[model samples]
Target: MPKMKTKSSAKKRFKVSATGKVIGSQAGKQHGMIKRSNKFLRNARGTTALSAPDAKIIKGFMPYDR
Candidate 1:
């Protein structure tokens, strides 16, 4: 059988947590850093678990991750 390809974008952007949840980095940190407040930058610094509905879809793209 042909290999099932994972979504390249999802592979790069999301992580599968120990609890089997999908996590992703907060957006808005990619640009305009100077205008962003310290609190906003700090809060956006880490990965966050995606909501259940979103995580379900992401898991479909990352078949091997599970």
Candidate 2:
């Protein structure tokens, strides 16, 4: 059987943590930010874990992570 390939886009956007959680950056921080609130900007500064269902889907693409 052929090897299953990882999804390039998913690989770039998502990361599998040491404990097997999928961590990802918050959106809306990539574009213009001057109009956004200070609190909004601050909150978007770190990675957040994906939900259970989304994490399952992300794990498929990050097979090497586990």
> Pick by TM-score: which candidate is best?
1
lDDT of 2: 0.88
What's model 1's TM-score?
Answer: 0.81
- State the C-alpha lDDT per candidate: 0.93, 0.88
Candidate 1 residue 27 C-alpha distance from true site, Å: 1.1
Q: Per-residue lDDT tens digits of candidate 1, residues 34-59? A: 99999999989888889999999999
Q: Residue 8, candidate 1: how far off, in angstroms?
A: 1.3
> Which 10 successive residues of model 2 have the least lDDT summed?
57-66
Cα lDDT, model 2, residue 5: 84
Q: Which residue pairs show collisions in model 2?
A: none
Model 2 over residues 1-66: C-alpha lDDT tens digits? 777788899999998888989999988998889899999999889899989998999899867777
